[model samples]
Target: MSYNSRTIDLILKAQEPNQKQFTTFQQFFKSNNPPPLLFEKNITPKNVKAQRSFSNKTQDSIKETKRKSLSQLKYPEYRMLKIYARIKPGECQLNYDKQSILIETNPYNFDRVFEQSATQGDIFDIVAKQTVDDFLNNINGCLIAYGQTGSGKTFTMFGESSNPGIVLRTFTHLFSRNQETIYVSILEIYKDHVYDLVSGVQDLKLKEDLQLGFYVDGLKKIKVDKLESCQELLQIAEENRHVAETKLNALSSRSHLILTIQMGKTKLHLVDLAGSEKVNKTGAIGETLQEAKKINYSLSCLGHVIQCLSQGQDHIPYRDSKLTKLLMDSLQADCRTSIIVTLSPESKNQDETVSSLKFAQRARFIKKEIRIATQKKTYRDLELEITQLKQELLETKQRMSQTSSVSQFQCRYTTDSEIPCTESLRLTYRSMTNENKENYLPNLKTQENNTQLELENKINQILVELQGLNKEQSLDNVKRQVAKINELTIDMKKTYKVLVSTQGLNNNQLQIQSQFIETQQEQNKQLQKIAEQISSMDSSKPSFNIAINNMIKNLQQQQKQNIEDMQSKLEKVYYDIKKNTTVQDYNLNHLALKLVASPNRQQQQQQQQQIKRSQSKTNINPSVKYLKNKK
Candidate 1:
């Protein structure tokens, strides 16, 4: 049979009564059925009862076994409900049933219900208002709408034609508040690819270098100035969303969408994940099948991560999938986070509802410190303001100098110089007119006054230029200091790298030294063993003499060789120490000396040599031996 046929048969057999027997039958059939048995066509009720008695007992035993298993089973601590239905019109309703506006809808009614309710102040308005208030208060905030596909997740998040979406409402509120700085970056993670919906060409051609990982440890942030721009960006992203036809709905999102809003220092991440669907229900084919598989794998990994976290397992498998890994920081208890779970209330979607509910329930147990970190303006803005002030001051100073120069020129002609010349002076000048002073007096006075005024203006201009030069010089000094600081920073980095390398080298050297010490210890043990062997030999007569002689000779040779080697190593060490007597080198020398000493052998050799010398002296005397024999 074909592989597909075999797979189908296996599935069918798995569902059969007497599963073990069915499996056996399947295996036998696969093996071409080596033997077959035919049973009796009919039996009496009494006979049947007798036959079934044994089976009944077995069934009872099996039931008891099943009961034990049931007893051992643990109920889920949290339930995750995954909504998987579409929002069709007329399937849901909206009413102010609860204190807050109540939206009663299944997946089918989501879009229509959201349209009608959003017109009357929907959940988006509530969340947006809260976010705006938070923004104004210098607190960081986030509002995320989460739900399955075709469940009006998109519509609720971003409403239909008559109503604006959460994103639009948020910006509208933000603009209205006008109290914070906002930047928005819209992106879609489709097939593990991040695309910039805004700032790219209108042709939907994604820029090659514009891709960003959806879950980056350090994501670049965008700054938004106004709500209109944010809304425009959102519209662009919506256009870029990857949509495809599925069995359930057309325009089904094929990728996860993330819209990030950065307000000053705080970041708000609004994520709309693609609805998860079972492959059999999706009826996905070809590339869609592959895409579905990847989606399911990632989603499953996310589920596992959630499960592990709920269980307080130390090993959360975030690294198993990109999605989980990216969410690591957000999921951490330190990060202030809130999850809004949207669900389809349809009874037909019991499984999806349960899954989504369970997910929400698990999320409820996750205790996070919900602190809204308000973004504080950095020094850069202050610096810019200071620069602008300086420029204005300089301009004012220039204008003041020009005004002073003009006033000085006007003053030269005013009051004192403008006074009418005295008649007496005119007469005197007339008397001396022929003698050369009188004829040019008015011209000389005018020239002198002009020269004086010109001098004063030059002095004032010089002072202004000097002041400007001083300012320039001061600026240059500041620049020099900044450069010096940069150089120092570079040097510090270099020093840090050197320190790190040195530390690594030190650790390695320590390890090597430890190993060397261990080897020396082993050698010392061996040498002790050898010494014990030599001592044992000394206790034996003939063997002791021969062994002692051989050992003495070997020792003499070895001592000579070792002395030479030591001298060579010492000379090398001496030179090395002279060149660079680091603490490490000194330690090495001491260790080397400890290895060369053999205390036991040296003492024994000295004793033996002394005895031999004494014996030789006694033998030379000769009379001693004879006298000793007579006694």
Candidate 2:
């Protein structure tokens, strides 16, 4: 019999005490086939007949049941399957349900109906075993638990019993096999920030400088040793996970939790994503609302990634969210991946279940080739070995050359008679030296004296030439100094004349300014007297007073205007002198003109102003002050 039939038979037999009723089950097993059991037979035949008698009731019921089953199959709504054991209000229960596949009770405890339920095994155990086997074989696997709020995805993936979770089981298998070295790294990708959970402990004092794209772009991978270490890392990450209570479920995860296991060249990623739910349904508020938004965004990004992978699009928006980016490698062709979608088995969550199944169905079409990273030795070791070999070769060549030289010396000594005839001629000359000494001595003495005299004459001529060159150098230096002194003296005389001319101009300008100030003071006194006379004659002699006032106003305006014009002219002159002084003849002519013209112009202006003020005073009306007082 098939596993399903055997399990059904076992459950039926356990429900009743009689062995005879179970004979039917045995006969069913012997036939190796069993018809679908009809629960209507358990209902009274009278009641069935009464129901059938009521206007095609039995046919209608059958048609309705068929239609419902067909609709469910045709739509094939997705669901997150959660198999969990929990303690209910009054009893313990193991909950196994799929939202797309309806079940009867709310707190359906497996322990309550352990004998009645299927006996072969819980589906979770079967799936977990298959996943663990895949992990051991170095195939990248994913067990994703996804569902609406309050669905038992977490409980199914992580069992409450001491046997540990699928995560712990997979690690144990890795440790036992010893076939590959396992490195476990844990991180939480929330709101685009990749936080290292293992390194943040105060005692362990792991640094926070863990980069997001340390090992691979858009993937948060950390290198760790051993499965136990990974488990600890996972525990740390669990503690750090962002969770909040919702209306449907307490302690609902607000972020996707991804646990990555790298085994030798293979990587396995297990993701537990937060379920998608309506804000109204979840009753999330404040911070919970923000978390829900992030979760939804990440889940949407994951959907986009799956869709992109299915279509083989060039750009997969993995970087759009932290959760997607962290799975960049796995989502692509770099690893084998499997998605285990979890769902709730409640009619209320039918919509969520349908969406989940549709997403999974689309994900099934994605084709990702398994890419294994090839291992190679590091270059540093190879470079060091090469350097050492080169040094040894050089030393060997040097030793060989030295040995060859010594052998050449020995060979020369061994072949002494092979020396040239010049050595024999030298020996014959040495033997005849005494006889030839007397004959050669006189010629040698004469030749030596001639050579000595020639050497002395050449030395004396060289000394005389050196002395002449030294005297010429000295004379040239003296002439250069005299020329420098003459240039300096000329510059000094010119500078002195310029200074004397500047001093004389300054004295003349001071005298002229003093004289102009005296003349301006006299003009001011005359203007004051004229102003008093105009005020005394103003009322009776309107025309005369108007003329006087006009004259005073005109004189004052002219004086003010002249002073402003003179000041502007002086500024322009000084500015031009400063700017044009560097031109060769411009500075000398500009200085002389300024010194001669400034004083003479000031004296002429003083005389002109004195005459104008005297004339204006003579034209003043005497009665102007008396008229003004009466008005």
Candidate 3:
């Protein structure tokens, strides 16, 4: 009479078929032969219907837990999509007099709206800063730039050296923290087919798991290190991305490029979508015509998915297009999504602008359910990953053995000394993995930046009063970059002189001004030494000047208070001595002259002449030179 545990569990689950678990065992007893579970027995329900039911559940509010591990938030709430609008600077081309103009009088608002004058820093600080902070806690995030063709979508996502875009800015911010071990994969969806940008692998496969969502298969993953390395990688991806000349744009992106940043189990996606356009306006023909059709179709599908999610449809057609399917997790209730919709004020594209606004408005209503289970992998998936990693390790060893020419000394046009030779004598410092000058760098950079830490400690020692100043909040624009010798020296000199004044005395507060001014001439020499040390070690840190500036400010205030206190104490001591003592004076008091007071005046003159200059101030004074103890 042994009962199988599986049967008992299934019977219990069948009692409350709709619930996550059985509510009562009494229903199991009523049926001696209970039916098996409808789909499959799984710890996490895999049925599409079950997933829908959970998604539809109305929660009162986002619930917070008392405690959790791994990530700070185990159950981050399914938040609404964070959407923004960026208005590119241009004259209103839409004719106000024309009745046929497509423009909304009362347009939909968003979480944040950027004006035409907004800088790249402004966009990042408001949108991506908090997400990056959360990323360190292991929460996944996604940033998507959506807009019409030539509407500054790519420009907003990736900017120039003078003003870095979100992608470059993100890399700088992420690496500056020195926390996560991040890897990168770049891919583009062109003509509804995925292609790896880095490895130039064409037509990669899209794999989907019931719970884990969709991911591209066979894409090469590159390890990311310094900010320069990220820039190089991004350059390669951009070069590989599909682009063409159009009537409206000189260089137009024809594909949707997605950069996936992998850190352990967490992933952050940076998607730059091709702008939507009117085929008539674009004058797209031939191959460009076909690309336009696919791009428009994909964007429309995205809009449709948003429409469905807003209406709470039972079957959202996520599988309708590759673009939607690939970005499913980002749009759905799992990954945190932030959308920057770029808009052109031109009258020609007013219709597209209105449509984009509507799409974003609907997208704002979609909420992502942040369950405790951020780990998208299942046991079977882990097993497969293990197998894959082992295969990768095997392949690595095979490649290492095969790449003997690369690992060992090989033929070159010239020797290391620029001598004409066929073979190089130098051993390869790089392993099978790709490397540059940075690879041979110190293992110390593997952790935190020692140079930054040491600089901070030195600053902390110098300005002890400002120890409470938040280390996290680095004062911006207060001082120039440490690398900028001229600017930094000027900024530091001004900040340093705040404590000094003009009155002349060695220790006098007023005289301190001249001392500081004199030192200003040599300021460049000292600044160069500091900048060289800091920049040579880690050029990523620009806070050195800012920290020093703040330190100087605090030190100046502290110096002023100290000078005042010292002056007050000296004055008080002088007055106390004056009140406690007495003094008397006598005209020439020579020992011989005291006895011959009635003698001639010549004797008095002789006594006066004999008097020492030290005693000339006063012949007799009752100043206490020493105090003798009377026992």
Top TM-score hit: 3
Q: Which ten residues in a row have the lowest lDDT in candidate 2?
A: 107-116
Report lDDT per candidate.
0.48, 0.49, 0.61
**What does candidate 2's lDDT look like per residue over 1-631, in tens digits?**
3435545544443233256656765565457563234221221222323323432444444544553343334222222122222211222222444222223332222111212132223433554455555555444555666556565555544544364556766666667654444666655555545555555422111122232232432334556556656666667777777777788878777766667777555567666677787888988788888778877888888888888877888888877876776666556543445455555545566677557656765676676553332222233433454455455445434433432343342334333233221232222222233445334334333433454454455445444444344334433443343344334333323332343343333453344445444445645555555545544442323375356446545555655554444334433443444453444333333333233233366764554454344435544222222212422
Error of 1 at 32 (Å): 99
List, residue by residue over 273-380, the lDDT tens digit for candidate 3: 998999999999999999999999999999898889888888898999999998887776656789998888777777888888788888878766665435643435
**Model 2 CA RMSD to the hidden true structure, in angstroms:** 41.6
Using all chains and alpha carbons, the TM-scores for the candidates as numbered come to 0.41, 0.39, 0.48
- Model 1 residue runs over 4 Å out of place are 1-120, 200-223, 312-315, 333-336, 372-631
lDDT, residue 533, candidate 3: 43
The global Cα lDDT (0 to 1) of model 1 is 0.48
Give the TM-score (vs. native) of candidate 3. 0.48
Worst 10 residues of 3 by lDDT: 622-631
Order of the predicted models by TM-score, top scorer first: 3, 1, 2
Clashes of 3: 3
Per-residue lDDT, model 3, residue 89, is 81
